[model samples]
Target: MKSDMTKGNIAPILIKFMIPLFIGNLFQQFYNMVDTLIVSRFVGADAMAAVGATGTIMFLILGFANGLATGFTVLTSQSYGARDENRLRHSVANAIILAVIVTVITTFISVVSMKGILRIMNTPDNIFDYSYAYIITIAYGICASVFYNLGASILRAIGNSKVPLYFLMLSAGLNIVLDLVCIVGLDLKTFGAALATVVSQGISAILCFVYIYKKQHSIWPEKRDWHLEARDTSHQLRVGIPMALQFAITASGTMIMQAAINLYGSVAVASFSAASKLQSLITQGMPSIGQTMAAYAGQNFGAGKYDRLKGGVKNALIIMTVYSVVAAILSTSLLEPAMYLFFGSAENVAIQLPWAIPYIRFCAICYIPLSAIFIFRNMMQGCGFGFLPMMGGVVELVSRAIMAALSMKFMIYELASACDPAAWLTTGIFTFVAWLYVAPKIERMFSGRQKVID
Candidate 1:
């Protein structure tokens, strides 16, 4: 299961690695999508809106956890590529230590701040309690999310994407079953949905840990691996904190946009929420490819295959560009129908569709820039240039803040809809430029080292 990305034809290997990652990503998204669908259908539209309202905040906290876990794995991947088994084991062990600390911090902050965040977003009085219950429950489950991401990330770091995908698939199915049992059978509503997600992810995390312990001997930590060195911790934090902050910053922008949307009341919030879910589903492939590039670039960079890394980036761009076009067509064509999946009542669908459709279409049309953001930014992260990507996230936060402010000032719902595409455009351009500047320096540095060796 441990494959080497540094030695294959660029496009085929990338695609092969990418397909499982894309599918796994889809299944991961399904956890939330299913929660929304079950909550909307059984508990009512208000309940669905409550769950939806929590989306950005969930992204803020949980995204930081996942991003940190991923950043930890970059070192693992590099160690794998360089054939440093000792370093890989140490990286994995240190990552676990950091993840535990992060889990405790993230869970406490998110749970304690949950209600205040909702108030800041101006959540409607109608759904305030439902939103609070749902998100706070999710906040309590941060450990599950963090460890699952950490485990899956380690598997992917060594070119073993399939095991994580298999476990994710199993957990996703369990999530649906548990959603129904709790939401419908037990009548738990939004709280139940959050609980189901947490439990399912916890199971996945446990399974991944078991697999690594039993099967992945190459990089598995021995007794000595547990002796954490300051250097190893520093290395993980150097990449992890910037990566985590990048996600947190982007989510902060989303929180800003959500606050502006909240000004329009629950109807707009519900519409945007439903549309956003559909868009995430449709464009899952972009991020999947981005993740693929991370591993691909990380491995090659570690192996000193700078030319191959460049080739992989080029191939990844081509793949993402083509996928973006298809995703656009799918979003515009399928979005209206997809709304029904969340809202069973025709009246509710009618109320939300008019507001939701344009937003989905606008984002769909601008998928290229969004796609570019994922590809280039992740490639940079994989290559150990984490700071610029974090700066790109800052650019995104500023763009969304500006748009959200404008939307609120003028009461134009349309401007709020434009926030995402605007952020994507600005962030995408910034990251691409950063890549251009960084890629040359990397190549030149490695080339000179090779010359010195010669």
Candidate 2:
């Protein structure tokens, strides 16, 4: 089931690897959107906005854990590329240990600090309790999010994207059913949506772990593999910490933007939330291609296939450019209908459309830079250059913070909406520039002309 990216036609291999990733990503987003739809319809707009308001803080905490899991896999992907079974198994073991440590720490911190963090985000009075209930429940289930991401990242590392897709599809279906049962049947409201997400993710994690146990015996850790070594642990943390910081830093910027949005009241929050989800669904291709590049570049880099690495990046850019155009077209075309679907009523749509439509359209036209952010950032990470992407995250944070600050001062909806585009543009340029600096050094290291430390 493991497809090696170090062989075969570059475009076809990448495309084949990318399809499952895209579909899996789509279903993941679909279920998330379902959460919002059900919440809005059954619990009302304020409830939907309450869930939405927790978005950035959740991203800040959960994104950090997910990022660490992803960074841990870079080494796994590399070991797989080098055909180092012993090292690959060690990497997997260390990753599991690290994931456990992270889960405990993040869960405790996030759960304890949930209410204060929501308050800091300027959550409106009407939705404050709802936000607390939703996010706190999600925080309690952080292990589910962490383990699922770790499992999926490990699968992708070994070039087996299909298995995770299958489990995720199962998770999505279960989530929809649970969302209805928890929200409507049990009258749990926002907490039900969060609980459904956590439980579904937990199921996917268990299934993914089982699959890896049964099928990936070659890379599975033995008793010896579980004995942690300082060098291996250090290596994993070197990549994982920076990657986690990158996600945390970027989420902080969004947290700032969310604060700005909160000032605009519940309607703006709900509209922005709905529009953002729609954009994410439409633009799934960008991240999918980025993830493909991560594995592709990781495997090729491990194999010392510099030309193939370069070729993969080139091919990815072409694919992403074409996909970005298609995504932009789809976002613009689907705006009205998508808004209607999210709110489930024309009356709600009429109120939110004026704010949501332009925001989505603006983001659609800026997909190229957004595409660049994903491709180059993941390419760098895949190539064992984690620090560069973390710096790129700083660039994103600064851009969003400045935009959010300006939006707050001016009291303008347009400025608030501009936060994402601005951050993408800035971070995209930074990552591409970082790549130019790192690529030559990678080639030199491969050529034995220079020594590079990852």
Best by lDDT: 2
lDDT of 1: 0.90
Which clashing pairs does model 1 show?
none
Candidate 1 TM-score versus the reference: 0.98
lDDT of 2 by residue, 1-454 (tens): 8989998899999999999999999999999999999999999999999999999998998999999989988999999999999899999998999899899999999988888899889999999989999999999999999999999999999999999999999999999999999999999999999999999999999998999999998888989888667988888888888889999999999999899999999999999999989898989998899889999988998898899988888888899899999999988888899988877778978999888876887688789999998888888899888899999999999999999899899898788888888898888888889989999988987988324433
> What local distance difference test score does each model get?
0.90, 0.91
Per-residue lDDT for 230 in model 1?
94
Worst lDDT window (10 residues) for model 2?
A: 445-454
Give the local distance difference test score of model 2. 0.91
Cand. 2 TM to true fold:
0.98
lDDT of 1 by residue, 1-454 (tens): 7879999699999999989999998998877788888888898888888888889999999999989999988999999998998899999999998898899989988888888999999899999999998999989999998999899899988998899999999999999999999999999988999999999999999999999999997678888888667988887888899999999999999999999988888888888998998889889998888888889888988899998978987888899899999999988888878888877668878988988976887688789999899988888898888899999999999999999999999999988998999999898899889999999988997898899989
RMSD of each: 1.0, 2.0
Q: What's the true lDDT of residue 349 in model 1?
A: 85
